[model samples]
Structure formats: C-alpha cells, structure tokens
Target chain A: MQAGGLPDTNQVSTDPLRNEVPVTALGEASVETPTRAQALLRKIEPYLYLLPALLLVGGLLLYSVAHTLAISFTDWDLITPPRFVGLQNYIDAVRDPTFTRSFTNTLVWTGGSLLLPVGGGLLLAVVLERIPGQRVLKTLIYLPAILSTTVVAAIWSYVYTNNGVLNETLRWAGLDALARPWLVFAPTNTLAMIVASSWRALGPSMVLFLVGLQTIPPELIEAAKIDGAGERILFWRIKLPLLRPITAVVVIMSVIGSFMTFDLVWVMTQGGPGRSSETLAVTMYRQAFIMWRMGYAGAVAVILSAIVIVFSISYLRATLKRSAL
Target chain B: MKRYSNAFWPLLVALLLVPALLMGGSIAAQDDPVVIDWANDAAWHEAGQDAVGEASLGVTGIGVNTVIFTSTDTYQAAVRGALPTDDAFPLFDWWFGYRMKDLVDAGLLADVTDIWQGHIDKGEYPASMMGSFGFDGRAYGLPKMINYWVVFYNKHVFAENGLEVPTTWDELMAVAEALKSNGVTPFGLDVVGCRWCSFIWFEEMMVRVDPALYQSVMSGETAYNDPQVVAIMEQWRDLLDAGYFSQPGDFSDNWEAPFVNGDFGMYLIGDWWTGSLERAGFVAGEDYGVFVMPGITEAGNRSLIIEGRPLLIAANSPQLDVALEFADYFMSVEAQTVWAETSDINSPNLLAPEETRPGHLVDLANAVANGEYELYTRYWEATPPQIVEQVVDLLGQFVLDPAALQTVLDGAEQIAQDYWASAGGE
Candidate 1:
C-alpha cells in the first residue's frame, strides 16, 4: 500500500501461512505481526542508534571542508555576495609576494618546529630515563607546558627585548657588541619567534616521548644490556625502534602545529617589521579578516590544508607500510 | 543494551530542539528593552562602553551589552565573519572613512540617514563632517569626534633648547636640527615592536605634500609612485636621515619614560597621544603642548588628518531600531560630553561645551573652524583596507631602509593597480 508517495514501510508480506513452520504443542504462529515489527526493528536498531552521531560529525566536518573548497574558487569579501571566480584566487596567490613569503616562512617554521621539538624531546626523554633525578627534572621541563600561550609569549618577549636579560648577560660577559634586537628584523625575528614556539611546545613533546618510552619493556633493555649493548647502542638499536610509533605521532602534530602558527607570531610580531615573519596561517588570517578578502583567504587556507595533508598522508603511509613489514 | 539504545533517539531529538528554542527566544527578546549587542575594539572599548553606560542611564531602561576585544584584528575579524547575520552585534565600533562605503556597498550597514539628518536639521552636527560618512546621498556612520595628528612637544625640552613651536616646514626642520645637535632626540618615535606605528609619519608627509593628492592616492585614483607621493616619501626619508627620531623604540606603551623625561623633545602624532602623556602623569598644557604640523606649501589650507573610532549599525541586526536609537543618543551632545569626559578627547558635535574638551583638542578645534586648518580623515582609514594593508607594509619597509623608497613606491604602485582594478571590477 502507498503512503504519501512512498510504500508503507511497516506493511507485512502477503504470503500464505501454509508454508510457515508449525509448532506442535504451543500452536502459536512463529511469524506473527508483532514479531515481524520486532524483526525489522532488530535489523535497524544499531543503525538507528548510530544515525544521530554520524549525522552530527559527518554533517559539520564534510560541510566545512566542502564550503572551504567551494569558497576557494569564489571572490567573496564576507559582506558581499560571493562570485565564482574559478582558479583566479589560487593563481593570484602563486604570484602574490605576501602569499609567497608566508608559504616559504611556513616551510621554514614547519622544518624548525619538527626538528627542535621532536629531536629535543626525544633526546631529553632518553637522558632522563637513565638519570637519577628524573621526577624533579621532569616536573621542571613540563612546567612550561602548563603555562598559557600569552604567558609564554610575554616571557619570551622580555627575554628577547634589546635591554632584556639576554642582552644584559651578554654585556656582563664582555659581549656587548654581540647583543642585538632579537625580534626587530626578518629571518632573525622569525628565528626568535620559532625559538619561543619551540620552548612552549617542547614540554608537551617531551611528555609524549616519556609516555611512549615508559611503554617499552624494561626486560628487553636489560636483555640487550646483558648482550653487551652499550648506552648509545641500546638507544639506536632498541629504544629508537620501539619509540617509532610515538615519534610518528609527535612529528605530524608538530609539523601541523607549526603550519598553524598564529598566536606566538601575533603576540610577538603580528607578522610585521614588513610582513617578514608571517606564516601561512597568519597570512590567511590577514587576508580573510584584516583585509576583508575572504575568497583569497580561503584559497590560502586550501593550499595550507593541501600541504598539511600531503605531509601527513606521506608519513602515515610510510608508517603503515613499515608496520605491515 | 536495548535499554541504552532505546533512550538515544529521543535524547538526540531533544538536544536539537534546545538550540532551536533558544535561538527563537533570542530573536523575540530583541524587541524588549531594546537590548543591543555592541562589539568594540580595545581602543574605543573603555570610553565607548562608559559613554553608553552613562548615556543609557540618562534614557531609562536600555541594556547595552558590550564585548570588548583587546586586539583590533580580532574585532575586525568578528565584523567580517559575523556581520549580515543574526549572530552579529546590532552596533559595533569601527573606523571612520572609506571602510563605511565598502560596508554599505556590501549591504552590511544600515543607512542611518534619518538619524544623521535629524541631527543636521537641529544644527547639532556639522554638514562638512557628514559628507565623509555619506555615499550616494545615504550616510552610513556618525562622526563621533576628531583626533587630528599634531606635534606633541615637551614644554621643558623646548624651553631648555630655546625652541618655540614651529609655524612652518623650514622652522620645524631648524628645530629638529637644533634639538638633535644638542643630543636630544627631536621626535619620540619609539615604534620597534609596532612597525605600523611608523605610518603616521607617512600619513603626515602625504597630507603635507598636498591634501588633495593624498586623498586621490587614498581613493586608489593615483599610483603610489605619483611624483607628489614620491616627494612625500623623500621628505619622510629626509626626516629619518636627519636622526630626528629617538633610537630603539618603546613598543607603543605610554609608560615608556623617554618622552616624559624630556630625552625626546617632541612627538609628531595624533593629538590623542596627549592622553597617553596624561596617563603617564604629564600635565597637558604645562608639561606637554600641541601644534598644527605645517605642510611644505599651505596654499591657505592647513589640512589636518582626523582619526577616530566610529560606531556602526548592522542592517541585519535583530535590534536595529534600538541600535539606531542608541546611535541617535550616541551622537547627542549629552553622550558626547560623557564620552569626552570618560575618553578625554574632542567631540565633533557642535553642541558639546568647549570646557568639556581636552586642553590641546580644544585648541585644535578652534584652529580647525576659525583658522586655516581643514579637518580630513586619516589616510590609513581613507584608503581601502586591502590596499592599506599592502601599502602600509611598503611604508614600513621604507622606514626600515630609507634608500628603498624608490623600491617601496614601485611595489606599492603595483599593489595599488591590483586592488583598485579588482575594486573597479566589483
């Protein structure tokens, strides 16, 4: 039977009961109307429970990604009606000086962010595992992680100021000529901000490394030690291989975080002294929000997302392949 | 498992309705008490809020909900993203000038012409000032006050060095020379952390070369490499070359001691900077004084760049009526009085008593109406924001390396072509 342009979903099959299996003593029909409804419900119950969550998650995530992609091809200034301009925004970004500079700075930021945090954290974790005062030293290193980004930015700004402690120490050590303004120029300013970002990020990276290292069986290390494996030998041969999974996670996170740098750069420099220290994220922000060029900003964001996805997918595939072997 | 799964669907449906009910209630609530949302950038946040609070007190039972963002960029982002939607504030603090035209063109701003016209008919607001906020006979904003860029000089430094406030370009240069030779920095331009702060000198020089030419450049009609613009940059470079400005800038905090202690003799900036001096315990007239910055050639028009925070009404706001009411109140002399008292600045409303003004602002206003001074909006706001972002960066580059003036101008000219061409197409 039809119901509002669709079939009645609860309709029962028009089959004779003669072919149904018979119960001798109870004499109750096995395929009754109530059981048919119950069977349908049983079949769809799991999906019914999952539908709400799936709709919410898939709806937001897919909608946002789709919208960003669509907006990348349009000329929208947030206030104005969006006009589809195809690949013009991306083509413009390719030649735009600020975009190019930000793209290059993003690469540098990512490279520095990856190496400093991941490497330093790994090395520190290794050293701490063998050291006597592990707990106290761990707390000291982890303390910075708990401090807010604003607090970190303020602390570093003071440390990097021309008359800050760094310069004062340089003067006291008869190196007054060597002291200079850290956040006042290009490349140097970018490097200074990167140092501050890494300082704030290193604590978490070390903690992740420590957690990963703790999961490794001490018995295996002892066994290696008994087999004449020295300190360096053990780290390279066993601990390093064992820590690969966590390292993969750490590297991806650090690289992504670096590409997404805004708060540190904003608080420290605000992408200034001539837009020299701007990263991809900061450029996107300036374009979309400050400049009121939302479409071009979307293009920048899409490029940033593509770059991030490329690195992440490449790393993930390599890790998965290694695991497969 | 059945019991837990059975409860989930109803819960999910209920959750969706909660937001719907709340959203529905919000739209309805806008009709009563005329509760309007106001988003303010930090510069105007404190004074604007105080003025509204005090003014709303005068009008019985009006709720002005304000959210203040410390960073200008953050608040600008909010307006760009949240405007033309129910979520956006009915009223927001904005900059006066070309920004309004763009917002109006995009249909994001309400044409508050009636409110402005009502004030005009009553002889409360000036007709000359209203022209900047108007486009195609429809006005988009209210001219709140004027903050003319002026020379703020330390009185004691001037007295010690036998210097008086210069009346012309030549005299100003001679004063700079005298002060610099005496080991005192002529200008208190410590803007290391904020490279954009250096653009005021560019702003000053642009208006100085020729106010009309500056306006043309701001409107994207003239290129940055225009002979007049080049001359302006060259003059700015000359000032930088003379070592007139103090070294190693203080990053824009008023608490910096150099300007107050008389190490720096003068600062060529907006008159509002006197408030910063006041906050730092410097008396307005005795410790520091202000003067109209002279152009190379006046031609009987001493043009001054006026910069200030503007209050704007969102067209799509649920509380549009009340926002307009607040705008009407905000432009009144009563509100302007409270604003100046709380903000310590000048009000554009003619009805505002002169005694309610800052000492230097009052002097500047007298010069504006009766003397040769012509008040114009700051070029930074006068130009398109997108273009301003690009050209200002070049201006900063010119400051970093004065020799790169030619390069900076060339780059700026290219950026001008791109944005202006796009704007024309639109």
Candidate 2:
C-alpha cells in the first residue's frame, strides 16, 4: 500500500511535469503554435522602430546617386530632352584641360588643408593644455569659424585687394616691395585663398583635438612620467596613439571639405585669374549650370564623388585597423 | 537587416509624406489666382515695377508679384534655374541670342510675333530695333530700350588737359599717352565684371578691323584668332602694358566716379551711364560729353556699338493672351514715354513723347537714329556660354599679365572653333 501511494504521488507530479515539458520539446511545440500578437510584436518590434530611418536614408541615397548617375549617361541641358550619349561625356571630360587642372587643384587643396590645419590644431591643442586663459583664447580662435563663409570671403576680399588693409599694413611696415595684387597674382592667388580657408578651419580641428585630449586618462601620463619618459615621449607615444580616432576624423573631414570647397572660391575668385583657382566642384558647377552641359557635369560629379569616397573608405579602414591594434 | 527594418516603414512614410506635402502645397497654389512673378535688376526696381504694374493693370487688371532681384549675376542665375521648371517668371528682362536662344530652343518663350507685328505695323517701334529680338524672321521679345556705347569723357578734365575729343585712332592713342604722362588714367574700366568692360573693347576692336568681320565672327562665320583679330588684341595688350587703362578691381567701385571727379580722362560705356552720372551730381555736356569712338583705320569710318534690352514672355504660360496684351500696352507711346521720363532710358518706340524725355537723352536718341552704327549684341549673347566665359576670363588674365596675350588669343580661337563645330558650322 505504501509503494502504491509513492507511485501515485510520482504520477501526479509527473502529470504537471509532462504539461510543462522539456526545453527542447517546448521549443519545438512553440514553433508549431500560432504566434500570439504579443509574440509577433516581440519579433518585429525592433524592425518597426528602425523602419523609418532606414527608408529615409535609403531613399535619399538612392535618389541622389541614381539621379546623378542617370544624368551622367544623358546629355540633358535641363531645358531639353536627355540625349543618351553613353560614355561620350566621360571621354569629353577626360579630354578637357580645365577638368585636368581642376583635378590637380583639388588634390593640392586636399593635401594642403590636411597638413596645415590638422597639424596646426594638434600643435595648438597640446600647447593649450598647459596654458591659462585657454577658454577665452579658444573662444577667440573660434570666432572666425562662427562667421559665415560669405562674410569671411567679403572681409578677406578686402584684405587681399590691391589697396586693402593687408597691403596697407605691409607698406606701412616698409615691406612695400612685397605688396602686389594678392588675389590676381598666380600661385599667390591659390595660396591666399588657402590661407583664408585655413583661418576658418583651424578652430574646429583645435576644438576636436581638445576634446580628444581630455578623453585621455591622467593615469597614463603619470605612468609614463614614472617610467622616466620625457614630455615629447609622453605626447608622441601615450597621447597621440590614444588620439588616433579623433585625428583620423579631423583629417578625413578636412579632406572632404577641401574637395567640396566652392562658396569661398566662387565669391572671392569665381575660379578666375584665368581659372587658376578653379577646383573640380567649381568647374562642375560651371559646366552643369552655366554652360548647360548636364551629362558632362554629371560625369565630373561622379568622378569627384568616387575620389572622395575612396579617400573616406581608406581613412575609415586605416582608423579601424589602428583601433584594433 | 534588423536595425534597418525598424526604420524602414517610418522612413517610407516620411518619404511619402514630403512629396505629398509638396504636392498638396502646389495644388493649393494652383487653386489660387494665376500669380505671375516678375523680377529685374535692383537699379531698375522702381521703374520696372511701375511699368509692370501699369502694363498688368491695363491688361489683366491684376497685380503681379514683382521681386527686385539684386545683382545682375544673381538675377541671371535665378532666371536660369527657374526657366527649366514650369515656375518661371512670366516676363523678365533678357538679352537677345545667348539666353534667349536657349529658351526659344526649349520652347520656353511665348511667340510674341503677332503682338510684335501689330506694334510694327502701327509704327509704334522701328523695324531696326526689332533686329535684336528677332531670330529666324520671328520676334520672341519686345525691345524696351536701345542704347549706344559712346565714349563719355569728363569735359572738365579734357578742357583742363587742353585736349579735344580725338577723331582718329592715332590721335586717340596720343591723347591716351598724354593723359598717362599727366598722371590721369586715360580710360575708366571695371574689368572685374569681365563682360561689362571687355564688351566695349571687343566692340571697338571689331569695328576697327572690319564691320563685316565683326558680324561674321559673332555669327560664327569667322575664326576669333584671324590675323586682323590678332592685330587688334596686340593693340589692346599694348594699351594694357602702357598703364593707360584703369586697374581691374571690384566691379562695384565707382567706375564712372573717377572720370566725373577728374581722376581719369575718359570712360567708354553705354549712353545710359549718363543717368548715373547725372544722379551723381555731374551735368551732361557741362560735366561730360558723349562722342563716337575714334576709327582705327584712315578710311574715317566712324561707328557706334548699339545694344538693346528686351522684355520677353514665357511660352508655356497659361496667361499667353494676357501676356501679349501686356506687351502691347507696354510698347504703347504713353507707357514708353513714362518709362523714358522716369528711368532716363531711350524708348525703342519712335513715338516716345518729346516732353517725357530729358534734354540730354533726347539728343542721344537723335544721335542713335542718325549715327552710322553696328548693333553689338552683348558679347555673351553672340557666343555660347562656355566660349563667353573662357574669353572673358582670358581677357581678365591678360589684363593682369599682358605677357599671356598670344596664349589667350590661341585659347579664344580654339573655343570659337569648338563652339562653331558644335553649332553645325556657319
């Protein structure tokens, strides 16, 4: 009677356990069960949340890239039927001396902007770390960045004019021999424009570097000091290695911005002094809007985008690899 | 994929939402009155608005939304961008050939031939004035004003220097050399606005070489670097090197002010410049005098470069009847006289009331009728936009560095050849 009672109890417990089931059996049964609204919601909730942004960004990317690419294939003047010309536009662009000059100008501009502004910013951020009144100085340095590009161009135009403040100051200081039409003279015209660009760009990179500098732990510096590392060694090994991500971001942004530069050059130079200062973007605008050659201009735009994308991808890859290391 | 899924529907909705909103707005706009937007240079704002209002009131009895577009450059760009869309201004000021041809080719310009012919038969305007606005024997626009580029020298400066207006090329260069020696730049030029100043030089050179060649070159019949053209460019280079010309600076600098203030000896510009000079407190004939530019050849052929500004109607506009009616009313003697009086512009309508014109303008108008002249379409109007830009930029560069004369000329020739080839040759 006692053994039968134990077996009966086990059977009763086993009934509940059978209903509950093993984890694997439960998983299998759930697959066959008509999923509840709550279960479906659980499955799709994340997707529902992401759907809007994905469609938005995807649509924009598709429209811009596709429209530009399509335009490159057709000789549409914006006022006429788009004549399909296949690869003729690309061939014409390659043959154009102006396009060649613009490509060179873009490369020089990107290289110059990166080396000068980013280098200057890193040096400035390091120096500013120990300097007092940096907050005020930083504000002062950033003032030019706050001004609109047009305003900067206007002020700089006057400064670069033959009879303007720059020449006036040089003449007053007995450097009259150095004074010339700074904006009209070749080689100097390109340099003068770059200087104006650098003035506007310096503060942003400086600010970025300052933020990067702060993210660096004080303990690392103290540890380097304990290891008898000099200030230069601490900066080169500890600080710079840690700041690689920010440096990469600054360099990449400056490169892209330099390639896309148009407004300042348009306002100040109009890609003139015999198209000496014409960049790829300006030439593209002239061809597309002014000359009404949409297909050729689109080809130029595509080439520019490819160049910039290549630079961005390379930079990102290098950054990621460095971070991994 | 999971990350994108959450955003996909919302983004699709938003993407669908924007265009819908824009379409809704556009449809709403359509239900409203057919609003006609008009624009022009700020300098002519008041006169333009008055003319537009008078024309619109007399015809459609509805006011147009007139925006005074600032800066000629900006106005050109805005009109260019808007012309491709159906939202272009119904009527706007445009030069002939360059922009007009593009518009006409695109069928964007309303055929105002019937209206123009009606005005022509009524003897309201001269047939000669229509030459600029007509292409393929059809008029697409109405000429509002005709101006001749005459040399305007400061009478006070010329008298002070004991110089009379030169009548020949040799005498003109002599005056220029003398003016330079006297520490006064012989010419007042705004070369920064490349087309504005360079156009005068181009016209003068073309006239000097051969009037036929000028027409032939502009009509794509002749090369730009012909021996005769090269000779003219060399002469221009010599002038540039001699420092007889004003420095190319900001175009907005008071180019005429230096001439009026006795800082320079002469200024070659359109007769419309007299209005600006007068407004600046300089009296015509007393402070300045207009004369034909000296001839380059001993044949004593004196010629003036004439240009016209015309008003054009958009082709696709639903209000075509109203637009033509407005054009006719605008060309009427009463309106032309009103514009001439207020703006100091020479109305193309020959019947412009004498009382409405300023005394100096009346004299200039009479000169235009009697003078032996070649109507010079704005340089860009005669050339493709690409060639025009290249030529102007090259001219500016030459002004900066005169040593690039041959290179600039060669480049211009190449551009001209390419342009002609593209146009299927003359």
Best by TM-score: 1
At residue B121, what lDDT does model 1 achieve?
Answer: 81
lDDT by residue for model 1 (B208-279), tens: 768888877777778889887888788788888888875542332332467888878887777767766777
Which pairs of residues collide in candidate 1? Answer: B190-B249
Residue range A1-325, candidate 1, lDDT tens digits: 3554532222232222222333222234643664565667767777877987888888998888889999999988777779999999999899887888998888889889888888999989988887999999988988888888878887887787766777889999999997877876778888888888888788889999999999999999999999999988998999988888999999999999998998888777778778988889988988877777788989999999998999999998998788677
After superposing candidate 1 on the true structure, give the runs of residues whose Cα lies further than 4 Å from its correct spot: A1-56, B1-31, B43-71, B81-89, B112-123, B136-138, B154-171, B178-184, B190-192, B248-263, B274-283, B299-301, B316-326, B342-345
Docking class of 1: acceptable
Per-residue alpha-carbon lDDT of model 2 for A50-154, expressed as tens digits? 877888878998788889999998888766678999999999999988899888888878877987789988898999889999889888878899989988887
TM-score of each: 0.87, 0.84
Considering every candidate listed, which one attains the maximal DockQ?
1
